[model samples]
Target: MSGHGFHVHGPHDHELEHAASGGGHGDGHGHADGGAASLSGGMSMTSKIAVCTAVIATVGAIFSYMGGSTQANAGLYKNNAAIKKTEASNQWNYFQSKSTKQALAEFARDTATDDVRMQGWQVKLARYEQEKTDIQAAAKKLEAEASQWDAQSEEQMHQHHRWAQATTVLQVSIALAAIALLTKKKWLERAMFGVAAGGLVVGALAAFHI
Candidate 1:
């Protein structure tokens, strides 16, 4: 106690104050380090997710392109089949015209009274028969070609379907990855990887034409 009514702090009071200040500074440093570590971890996870999503999107684009190409090929092949079928029909109609002319020539030859007239009619009938044979052979060949084009069209359509399937699966995987990033769930990340791998397998099947 002082005459002026002011009391100075003792050694025990000073020691207690210093200890309290030191403890507060230490606790602040600890909290700062923990926050920095958490921020670093979050940034790293965000980078990983961004990179993976980019790769998946690229793969899906490739699949979509392949599907388009196959579908276009199918259309072209189908058009070829139609053209061949039309040609076959034209040849068949020509053969029928030749057959009608050959029947009329035979009847003329059978009812002819003069030898010279009958001989001329016989020549005409033989020519008509040979022409009919050639026309029939051409028609059969055209029909066979049309059938082959139809088969090729079917095969291209099937390949297009396979590419479509692969693209769809990869899209689903990308969706899953986005969900995992938003929710920060480890199990969702695992599911995303599994689905992406399955999409790749389906893409392989499409490449091999299976």
Candidate 2:
């Protein structure tokens, strides 16, 4: 032992050993931090998906409402025009009957009163006919516009619904993936895969409906 100019067990050696043990403890803490970071990352991703689902659902509902409104307006316009046409036709018939009665009652065959009455009746009839035509034309135009609006609205609604459904599926899948990661369950991971596959099929079916 005296032959070695230094002591085998020095204070520095003990200090170095203690520092090495401390470094191992730090390494464990580092691993825990890394795990926590991974969990947080998963949660952030899930939150994003949930937000997207909400947005898509809102859009779908709006489109459905708009389509319904257009259909209702179309029906209203058509009904109103039909009622007006019926009323105008009834008034014209009444006027024609009155004119015939007055003309027959007069003993004079070619009286001015008869001519004036007939002319008046013709003018009323012409006005009624024009009104009827105008009403019918307006009704047709409104109906066509309403139908076009309904078609467009329905298409938008379908698209929105499809997106909403897809978002829901994605949200579920993300939740499942997070659980699988946390619990390290093989079954959950497999189940998540199945859910994702089913979602894709459902989305495809929705697209076909569109």
Candidate 3:
């Protein structure tokens, strides 16, 4: 066909060109969509890992703090028990004074007063002994519990450290893989995947130990 004094293409030619252009544009759009989807998935996975790491770190910190507090309490109780025992001994010494009987008589002038003072001193001595025993028992129990907590906290800390290390390696591998994905470097991607797999294995073994 001819139009405007020039040879013109038929409708089939124009349709062919349109179809070719449309196919190219569709393929490009598909590639873009795939890339976007891949990026979204990667970001989702990264965010999940970050959240998990934060939780682990927080738990480790809490356990560490609790262990420290338990140890401190154990020490305090032991010191208090020592102090109480010393005070009880001093009070007993006062009962051995040369004027002990005269002093007691003066302090308790009436029958009721004498009985009350004697009973009060006896009660004080008994209560002090009981308190000392209780403190010792409590200190021992706290010490044992603190030891257990310390062991647990140490194990957890070790696990967290291992995980942090493993995560670092995994992050590096992922970064490399991302670069590979961008550059179409199949070998680099494969290498990164292998490294990531090793990191996962190591992390699993470390967790088992913990």
Candidate 4:
């Protein structure tokens, strides 16, 4: 009877053993479920971060292109302004020379004593006056053209400054996006998007010459 009692489990002990085994199996299943959930969550976070990175990269590339194009345009305008200024100066000098000739012809016509000599000087003075009129018209036109070029160049430079500012902001936004991915901060990501939006607005303005 003693040996039988030692080898045979009672009903209560059997129930406890079964309960313990079932509890262990349930815990293992729970752990597996939790692990799967964690893995899924990690993948979702990574996907979001990847998307953010791609979008930020695209915006940054556009900003860089706009900034570079604006800077190039500014340089081109400056060169055009220089050419126009040089032409204007040349025209003014030509006008001055023509005026000197006209003045000399007028003085000679007034002072000539002989009839033939006075008549010849009067004809020459008339020719010089007509030439001066033509030269004055051309010089004034050239000066106006130079002034227009100067204004245009200044406008281009202003647009370039806008584009440069926009590019700087976009670059900062890209850095913030990278940091957002590392920190997994949704608010930081949103702020980065905000800065990117501002950059886009500025870039658009630059493109439109506003």
Candidate 5:
């Protein structure tokens, strides 16, 4: 084609030339060249999208692992809390038993006519009181420990929630990649990759529990 024709066609060089002159006399060669170029472009795009999808899938897997781990830890903490609470209840019951013994000892001392027997009953009552005090302290310590564990577990589970959100984004990105591949839209592919980046950000935050 002439300079005027080239000027009218745009800067796409060979492609513009082909369209301008309809491949001239070598129409077969021209069409073949165009087809080859189109195939190469398609292959490049497909490879890119496939790689993007694979990366997204990997991120999703990591997020899944974190979520599962955190949830398991949370459950373990809750179990420990329950066990501590039971122990605390048992301690309180023991305290009540000690109080009963103390009351019985007091009554026996009050009724005893013999000085030696009365002194022994009084000593037993004091021992019971000391034991009850010790038991109460231990029960309180156990309850405190249980509460700390429960809070830690809850924090871990909260991190798990963040991981879940990241995983969801990664999955959505994969789906977008699928649609982009089917539609053969480069812009859509780019958008899908952007989503994947966002997923990665969220995943990192989850991993760090931030």
Candidate 6:
């Protein structure tokens, strides 16, 4: 009455005020319930997806590192194989030199007129033959070592491939996770888990050197 107009109360005015107050409170409660439901349902899915994505990312990183390590090992083993091959080649060359020396010594012994000179040539021939034998043995040994290193390098390369495959699958899983988060599709989440499991299996294969 003081502000604008006279105020009047009907017989039902108190009930109407009470009803309005209750409706307001009910509307607030409904909104709170809706928020809680969203938290428990949608937010719950989001949290699970986030956690799984994080775990998958960590596993993918490990797989990537293992791939790199295996690749490095393969390269190192290949270098070792090359080094051994070079050593074998050197030994073979040394053996060839000894063979040439032995041939010359034999010729000298056969053609020599003096007995003392013949004896000296014979001694030289025997020494050269023994040296050739030793060098041949060393060369064969180095060749065998090179073969072993080559085999090891091949194994490492295979393992590197496995790790790379595992990492790639995990990366796909991470991509699916991002898509699921964006689209809120349960099917995408399932696919993400399946891909992630496949990635883990590949990683296991790599670990066992399969």
RMSD of 5: 9.8
Q: What is the C-alpha RMSD of each candidate to the true structure, in Å?
A: 4.5, 8.5, 11.2, 4.5, 9.8, 3.9
Q: Write candidate 6's Cα lDDT for 68-185 as tens digits.
A: 9989999999999999999999999988888888888899899999999999999998899888889999999999999999999999999999999999999999999999999999
lDDT string for model 4 (40-98, tens) is 98678768767866776786687677777767776787777778778778877887887
Error of 3 at 197 (Å): 1.0
Pairs in clash, predicted candidate 2: none
Most accurate candidate by lDDT: 6
Best by TM-score: 6
Q: Answer with 3 or 5, whichever has the higher TM-score.
A: 5
True-vs-predicted CA distance for residue 29, candidate 4, Å: 4.6
Candidate 2 regions exceeding 4 Å error are 1-114
lDDT of 1 by residue, 7-32 (tens): 89999888788778795468777899
Better of 3 and 5 by lDDT: 5
lDDT of 4 at 60: 63
lDDT by residue (tens digit), candidate 5, 20-51:
78665487787899999999999999998999
Name the weakest run of 10 consecutive residues (lDDT summed) in model 4.
1-10
Ranking by lDDT: 6, 1, 5, 4, 2, 3
lDDT at 152, model 4: 76
CA-lDDT, candidates in order:
0.91, 0.60, 0.58, 0.79, 0.88, 0.93
**How many pairs collide in each candidate, listed in order?**
0, 0, 0, 0, 0, 0
Q: Which residue segments of model 6 deviate by more than 4 Å?
A: 1-35
lDDT of 2 by residue, 1-210 (tens): 658776587888887887787954687789999999999976775565456445534544543454455455555555555565555555556555655554553324334367777566556655655665665566556555655655555655565566456556755765776687677666776676677666566566555655
- TM-score per model over all chains: 0.81, 0.43, 0.41, 0.80, 0.79, 0.86
Error of 1 at 123 (Å): 1.9
Greater-lDDT candidate between 4 and 5 = 5
